[model samples]
Target: MNSIVTLNDTNCPITTSLAIAEGVGNPHASVIKVIRQNIADFEEFGNIGFEIQNSISGAGRPTEYAILNEQQSALLLTYFRNNDTVKAFKKALIKAFFEMRDELNKRQAPAENLSRMDILQLAMQSEEERLRLEQEKLKLEHQIEEEAPRVAFAKQVEAAPDAISVAQAAKVIGTGQRRLFAFLRQIGWISRRNEPYQTKIESGYLDVKLGSWDHPDHGLKQSVTALVTGKGLSKLQKLWSERDQDHAA
Candidate 1:
């Protein structure tokens, strides 16, 4: 059997509803039901308390699972009226989680020290080299700004397309694909495996056109892309600008 609690690469202790059920000797379905009933409580605790994630089953079907952090795990355990064995497990779990967290912090201390030393070394660099590096960094920033579609199309409202792919939108918005997708999900613009930017179109936030294209692998795909209209472009420009402003603030 897999360990009920495992530390992620980042040293964060994480467990799932399944693991919690197993650890506490409860039915997984019962555990899931209780969590759903108290979903608001979990959400109030934010991402650290609980996160919904999709996983593949042994039968190759997708399943949704709740990934719980240590705090969430402890809270969940409290919901169950358990015997001595489960109570002991709960106590042990909490203790182990904190111990692991402390161990990780200790392990990271040397790396932090090395980072400080590196920063001091950089501070001692020759003035000319430092100036050159600063100039290069600024040049790179300028290039990135220039290349971003949002920056280029901000003033031209009439030239926007009807429907754009998530990849294209991310490029235009000057955000990573994954980051943009996550943001869109958070805003309820899209869900798992749903069309990108569809909610925006449905909500009249933007207009879109469905189109097909020849695929390099599959012969041809239909409705595989959405072209953003001129109006959509304007909306996107405003949204992206506001996002940038928020980040700057």
Candidate 2:
């Protein structure tokens, strides 16, 4: 191959004017003279990189030459009149440049594959983070919704309004009467019959009073009823929040 082509430091394929002269069977000084004269035209493709080379005759000053890429090479070839030798060398040079490019692409294939894989991995991670942040945002919105009612209830109870019936307290607490009754029993605040325990009543969390009602068959009758005081409302709210957190955990 007569070392037809090689790569520059930047990995670009280049041939020197000296190599062009050798390939075309021209005098090296003659080729240099042509390049120096037509340099402005050749520079239209790109800057022509000049370098001093070892003197061919191993005497006198070193020979000066211009480094050229494929396009610059084509332009330089136009300056020389067509000949069989020059034509043959042009074809060989074209083949040599193409072979160098193929070699470079083959060598870089693994690195290119790695770069594409890295990009894909980064994209996947970004998507995962986006999804995670979206889920957290939704969870926060749900929590705010749940807290809104509880906040309103807290403000109302702290104002210490008159004692209200257990049923009314259930409505303010955002639960059904039966559900509150069951929960009160579970925490031993009341009995299975849903009446406030005497200890709780004395502690000022509840009140017990006679509720009289008329029956169809019987005369007026009286039974004990439970009511929630303001303090009890506040405590129930706290307990309800704790229960929800436990369930979530």
What TM-score, over all chains together, does every model reach?
0.41, 0.43
How much is 150 displaced in model 1, in angstroms?
36
Measured over all alpha carbons after superposition, the RMSD of each candidate to the real structure, in angstroms, is: 15.2, 37.0
Q: Can you tell me which runs of candidate 1 are displaced by over 4 Å? A: 8-10, 48-57, 60-62, 111-249
lDDT of each: 0.60, 0.73
What value does the lDDT take at residue 133 in candidate 1? 62
Q: Give the top-scoring candidate (lDDT).
A: 2
